[model samples]
Target: MKISTLITAAIALAATCPATAQETKTVKLRILETSDVHGSFFPYDFIERRDAKGSLARVSSYVNRLRQEYGDNVILLDNGDILQGQPTCYYYNYVATDKRNIVSDILNYMRYDAATFGNHDVETGHSVYDKWIGEMNAPVLGANIIDTATGKPYVKPYTIIERDGVKIAVIGMLTPAIPSWLGEKLWKGLRFDGIEKSAKEWIARLRETERPDVVVGLFHSGWNGGIENADYTEDETENTAKNVDGFDILFFGHDHHARKAVVKNAAGREVLCLDPSCNAVNIADAEVEITLRDGKVAEKKITGEVRDICNEPVDSAYMAHFAKEIDEIKGFINAPIGELADTIYTRDSFFGNSAFTDLIHNLQLAITNADVSFNAPLQFNTKLNKGKILMSDMFKLYKFENNICVLRMTGEEIKNYLEMSYALWTNQMKSPDDHIMLIDERNTGDMQKFGFKNFTFNFDSAAGIDYEVDVTKPEGKKVKILRMSDGKRFNAKKWYRVVMNSYRANGGGELLTRGAGIAKEELPGRTEYESKLDMRHYLAEKIKSEGTIYAKPNKNWRFVPEKWTNPALERDRKLIFKR
Candidate 1:
């Protein structure tokens, strides 16, 4: 054959044959994260009887758009804390147990790739979370959570997701400090490991076994330097992102703080860390571009930001899909419970004695019939108006579903506990004009949303004891116990039954551990009595049986040196409340 003919035939065959597939391909990943949702599944708030600013429904609209834009590359993940907060979670968690939890339904409907089990999810106890997990379509990842019965991970430790030949390994972990807040009964048969250690171990094993192009860490704990107990801290996000050499991107929640940060790992690789805070207000977004050459990762670039879900339009389809459940929740929350004889405001609880904390205090004491009751205001500023008290009003009265507990505490321990509580509660007044409330300088803003240095929920007051708080006095010397409210002599050596919430008895606010000088490990054995039902249940029943609720402050405690404290209280209240 002629050379020209052969060349023409070769060109014709080349033109007819299929082109070579491109080995250098670019895969774009849009990682959308929702953390600490806390049961704002719908766009409405049953507790407040108002529309929520942001919720999963609004988020669903944006998530749908992203799914359409990126298709299979859009990965949806929840960083836990989905089982508590609003009335929806409470009702589904304990009240409406026969049906599927709304949380599980929302997550499954949104088609979450994975989710972590948060401490609050454990707060619902095994019966709820276990069932919820089984109902979810996606894997519930918890590398740190170990089932003591099987001596293995209670859920999937990590999940490997593949998109366009690019593999992504996601390792999920929770804070090991759950025991510090939740009682053993709630988190029974399971133990949580330190976040950093768990992440490192999982990353190491994944590297050894699976060859993933990208590694993602989905953590339920917060960033560094919080709730330090024993060797590990409550938030290991920073520690793990800095020291752990494997993870390319890390997302953490549980502290309920919105943040987007980058830290250089020990290997000099920059790792993106993002926390979208609580409520469904924000969504953490990470955009990753993977360049794959010959089916292997060649170059990768990642950038993260906090997306405002409030800006997203509410998804009508999402809302309509679960309208029945939403109506049921509303009906359950709006049901008539009893009647409030008079209004009780949480604002009054901040200064000295108030009807808000007293109501809970009385109920705690009544529930356990303990010698003394310890309580605090959970909500920052809210008032339950006079007249009808609906079932939802109970949420305003008592925030969480913590069980009533009575601890065998010595009188000295109680005094020390009160001292710690006041130390965390009030500011050290150097003079009459000095600010009385401990303002958190780091957290202060134009709104001064939360001026209190510590969480107000930690500021506990005694119900059965007459005591004085000298704001001028130092921390240890501030609280002076006069006597019991019933005119009984308070002996420091006497063993008194102290009634409080399970959160306190389990060392949540550190009133029992740090304040009373009792170690955390020994707290489980200190319980004298623990109520089977939540304190709110008893309160609801009590109110229903009585037909009318009448509660007022007993005025068992007061701040001393009225000359300095009285004026200071007024000034500080204005400053803190921004009135």
Candidate 2:
């Protein structure tokens, strides 16, 4: 039967049913949300160079089936980060001459109702956004993102949908930290206003003008915070660090954590908020029942559940088709361009090591031939194994499609970058009495300790450079340059080439990338080249060449212990790294 016919019949049946006998007119609004997708349309992982869990085909089947059952009552909304990650992004940016636009195909299939902007989404710059937004079936909304040139919101703040005689208002908001966190170039002339102020204003307008029976907030602002001076508080219910004065339900993204909670506004009214974990790892299903009296909603009840997508059975046909596609792309995904023997973890505390971080530093060194290399640890979704690593694995490791670039920096400029990175560590260390102080005792009073240090090491190179960071001294004071692996100290007067992602090269991480001290040179290759290289293909080639693989640690980097180590270190170590 046609979808229109199905929708018509469902609406008629719902209307004919006796409202009083049923206690409430039952309308099932199935909300299917995907946030921070970062262009993983298929189930493949670029770093692992193999098919991992999570496929858009499978997600499509689930969404389509639900929509068929509930008709117009079902809304599919993506919470942003649809761009970047995977070969899809790489192909669009580099190889695909026509700009095949992979996301367009997925959106056409899902028929998304709306989406919010994510930090990564802005990294592509405004031109790419304008092109993609024009192709999207749904509207991209964020009331606070103003185009400085026009002094107007980049997208509508909210949109109202009439589903089964009920008006549902969906509002969107991006994180306010876009400028500070992502850098000024990507944002350029854009200005991000406070989310609370934008939401309150839009909510009042939505209520006064549209009078929506239910108001739902679709936000990429992420859960509240544990970080100091964080704008948003970590509230399970509202998800906004600031209070949510309006909106009955809120769906949050970013932070990559799942939570369900109830939040109260200034008026002391309760609100429901839900956030699902990243990847296609989990899905949140929210069903709200609104009771109406004399054409107005008298009361409302909400029922929500989060389902593990990986645990669910995949549609056989969809899986088969995806498997075939993987086969075609196998050469690209499985190529064994690199090897590893030890597991790599991205999360770092005072003591733990990060293989991913080490790999990126190595890549920077190799690519730029710089005396010292530096990179920030990316919070990827999962861990990597010690054997034949594929491109797919790298894709999951750094999902953002950041381009790699080389920059020439003086010794003083390098010191400044170290200072910024050090700030993150000092800020994280909460108590002074803590053991494992960031700075070493010998270098405590040296003003030069306020600068950068460097060393070299051999760890898994997800990107392929090698460097070491001395964690014994206070953050800014600890970076020491041992040897460039090639035996070179970056010259302050003469230019030194340092490889970094375009985002970092452009000073994306609030890193100093401009002025007399720094000069940038763009590399023709894609920033996420390793990730988009087709890990499956790489892995297949690895097996063809060698049977098994081993990853060894490059011990060039070491840390000095301080007095403030976590007391629960032993227990916590088992809990964190025992996979």
User: Candidate 1's error at 489, in angstroms?
Assistant: 1.6
Q: How many clashes show up per model?
A: 0, 69
lDDT of 1 by residue, 414-433 (tens): 99999999998888899888
Lowest-scoring 10 consecutive residues by lDDT in candidate 1?
Answer: 441-450
lDDT of each: 0.87, 0.58
TM-score of 2: 0.70
Candidate 1 accuracy as lDDT = 0.87
Each model's TM-score, in the order given?
Answer: 0.94, 0.70
Model 1 reaches what TM-score against the true structure? Answer: 0.94
Per-residue alpha-carbon lDDT of model 2 for 1-579, expressed as tens digits? 999999999999989976664454656577777777766676666555566687565577677678778988898787777776566555554344355455665676568888778877887666567667777778888887888899888887788888887899988888776643443656788888777777778888886898888888888865654222234332222434236576777887776666677777677876777776566666667888876665677777876765667645566665464464445445655555456667776544223345556555654454445545556544423567776666556554454555555555655666556555544443233443433323344332222121112101101121222234443455456555444454554344554555555555553434553222233233222122322232223333443454443433444444333333343333333433442
Clash number for model 1? Answer: 0
Compute the lDDT of residue 160 as modeled in candidate 1. 94
Flag regions of model 1 displaced more than 4 Å.
1-21, 445-449
